[model samples]
Target chain A: MQARFSVDSGDFTKAGSASSAIKRMLKQLGVKPAVVKRVVVALFEAEVNVIAHSYGGFIQCDISPEKVNLLVQDTGPGIPDLDLAMTEGWSTATDAVREMGYGAGMGLPNMKKNADSLQISTAAGKHTEIRMSFSLKEGEDGVS
Target chain B: MAFHRTLKVRENLCKSCTHCMKRCPTGAIRIDRGHAQVEEAKCIDCGQCMQACPHHAIAVEQNLFEELFYFEKRVAIIPAVFFAQFDDQYSESQICQALYDIGFTHVYPAELGIDITRLYCVKGADCKPIISNFCPSVVRLIQTRYPSLVPHIGLKTTPSHVTALFARLELEDKGVGIFYVTPCPGKIAEFHRLAEAGSAFNGVLNMDTVYNQVSTSLAKNKRKFAKEDGAMSFPVMTGSAATWALSNGELAGRKGRSLAIDEIHHVMEFLEFLEENEDESNIDFLELKACAEGCVGGILTARNRFLASERLRYWATSLPSELPEPLVQRIMKQKDAMMDKMTTPIHEVSAIALDDDIGVALYKMEKVRKITDALPGIDCGLCGSPTCSALAEDIAQGQASIRQCTVLRLKDPKEVNTLARIWGEKVTGEKGEGK
Candidate 1:
């Protein structure tokens, strides 16, 4: 099964909509609670990152019995340094983003920590594409 | 899968008006065969249906008043809100005396257990944004709808149960029948659930039932008893415990950044947000209740919620903060046992999942989505279901059919009939009537 949701840039009000919808769908599919939580946490972070940093983006989710794959792509003023962006407290978020409680610099770190496998491709002045996979099987991907 | 429920529908009294069906937070009620039916698995027993019914068709199940005679010692565990049900003219001691007159050998305030829970169970929670399990309905709601958040629910048992445990220990070796006088059906359902797994109390009584009996006794013996006419001296709780059933009651003196959310729908919306951003939110404690003004707003409550809450708050101001020394000593006697009992985890109820198997659930979900899209967006509720999406879900589960949608039937009668033949009419009113 598959689903797609678009995220408008700086639309803090609707940042978590996609993640919430996907979470509900996964729950209906009887996915383990821990796995669903992981998916929601990772997807929410990625979704927020798109809204807070990029121009706009869309999230695509593909679900199977054993795993879920998510692709988040955005028109971005992309990360100049991947290592720096991956750090826990480093951020390029504007003061406006910080005021809204979104620019904690923990978004990427959270997504990396929650998703079983993550791959990101981005460059300065180019679009960013994030690919994350979560294993749904019991006792795999630390879900049990 | 069988569970205890305190609310039931009287078929004779139902008007099939769909009021209860629309008010149910869990969408557990559906009109069937010209009467409202409750899907037990989906019901959290929040009493919204009971409050919504115009004909008083919904009834709260309670132990008979005579059931107190089963034991030689009858103890009534009364919530503080019960006293607020009466006018200011009725003193606490007068009410206590009235309880004695109504066959209760002893009367104890339910919030006395709050002190016990605080001292033993409220500290050292590992789950960030700990959800309070004080409201049995909220706990059951989380268990049914937000199963993933079950681990976040604090392990503290409700104050009433804790108080009952103390009562049991104090009255050991006696033929004691401890009854919880509850302001809501959720508490009764909680007692029943606990009783199924072994409980400290013997039975449950609705607050309205006790209130009526006490009112009658008080009215009959008006001006007959003195202000302090040998009323049983129960332990007085701290001011916090006195107002603990009101909104924001649990967060009064708690540490950390805590939030108190009341009313079931508001609680559900917050829980949905919290579930999606669990790791990001820094909340330390949550006090969620199904009733708007907490226990005072319970469907079974007698007085207006605002008046009762004001009365309770006024009463709390005069109370002392500390439990009396001897009362603390009595609680200390069973400290080890009470603490052990309070630590049991609440398990999740996977009642809302579409299917036990992932593949089949996915297929059913897809079908529900398609059917939902095909149906009219306006949720008329004329088809007995609460919403179009609910009907679609029912159809996917083989419990309903597309022919039940009155709008679709009105729009394309021939197509609807053909679909009904394929789907096999499941609803009672969907039979061939040549519409």
Candidate 2:
């Protein structure tokens, strides 16, 4: 099954709805609590990143018997250095976002930590897309 | 031993009014067979239900009064909120003396524990949005509901544990039993968790129970303590620490931004805000209290919270700005003996899952969603569950049937009967007896 949700830029109130909806879907699909938690955390971080940095984005998810796949694509000022952004404590978030506790430079890092496979494709001053997959099987811990 | 909650329901007092089911922050309460039943796995023991219940059915477990006599040396660890419970006629010393007069070998003020916790904890050291550990209900909420945020909780043992352990060392007697006078069921639950870990406290004494026991003489009682009256010993913790019982006291003197939130529902909302926003709030310290106005608003307390807050504010002016030398020296000396880890590991409190198997849980979720779409949106709680979604989930799980929904039955009898027959057939493999 597949589901898609639109993400609004700078809409902190609606920032988590997409991730939360996906989380509910995954849990309803009978995903393990541990697996659901990881997916939710990863997707939530990805959602916030798009909201904080991008003009807007959409979350596309595909759930199968073996795994759940997620694609978060955004049109905004894309990352100049993906490696630097992935590094912990490295952030280009504005002071306003920082005050809200969003720009700890840990969002992408957290996504990487919880996702079984994380792939990011971006071009400077254009767009960024985060592609991640989480395994559904029990006892296989998400990639740290 | 695994963590077990102490909050209980007296079957006779429960009217099955669903008052508690609506109030519970975790959705842990449900009406089963004309009685309010608490699903222990999801209950955080916040005592909201206890206060909400008009019948006074909810109660927490505690050591019997007769059991206090067994301890060779008994000590009463009193909370600072206990001082505000009295009129101006009674002094803190007088309450300490009255507790002694009431057969307690000694009275140790919880202020001492507050001081110890404050002194040792490094506020906003490494973890941002650091949560206070003093409020046991808030701690339990984080543990059960927000397991991901467990690392953010302050790692300082509560003052009760510190004082109890410190008293054991000072008395040099292993048989010295420490009894806590708590304001809410959550604290009692904390003691139960501590007991599993072999804590210094031997038992818990309810504040209302002890207040009634000493209310008569606490104001009138007098005792002289000019060095020679050695048995009339009580720890003197006169400082800003006395204000620790009040809301936002933990955030006092902190350099960074912070919030002091009370009431269980607000705490839940704030935590959700934190979680949904990816923990980005600038608040450094979150002094989250389950009660309305911190400890003073606890369900078991006697006075009004605002009145208590006023009294506490007036009392705070009289306290010393710094800790007394003796307490300072004692805390410095025994710092090593204090608990290094304070946050209690918690399990998921939500019972939203339909089955252990992911495939089965998915099937159940679909069934529940379909059932929920048909039911009335108004969450009247006539079906025993707190909300319509909850009732739908229950029906999908087979713990309940669609017939339990009085609204649907009355509003659309034909649809109700048709749906009930379908579900009944699914369950029994035959035609169902229509309601």
**Top TM-score hit:** 1
Query: How many Å off is the CA of A135 in candidate 1?
Result: 1.6
DockQ, each predicted model: 0.78, 0.30
Q: Per-residue alpha-carbon lDDT of model 1 for A23-92, expressed as tens digits?
A: 8898888888888888888998999899999999899999887889999999887888999999999999
Candidate 2 ranges beyond 4 A from true positions: A1-13, A24-60, A71-132, A138-144, B117-126, B219-233, B330-353, B421-435
- lDDT by residue (B1-435, candidate 1, tens digit) is 356887999999999999999999999988878899999998999999999999999999999999999899899899999999988888877888889999998788999988887666455347888988889999999999999889899887778888898898888838999999999999888888887768999999988999999999999876974566552368788999989889999899888999999999999999998887777688899999999999999998999999999999998997888877887887887888677777546898978889998888888888888788888979899888999999989988887778778999899878876666655453335444322
**Which of the CAPRI classes, incorrect, acceptable, medium or high, describes model 2?**
acceptable
Highest DockQ scorer: 1
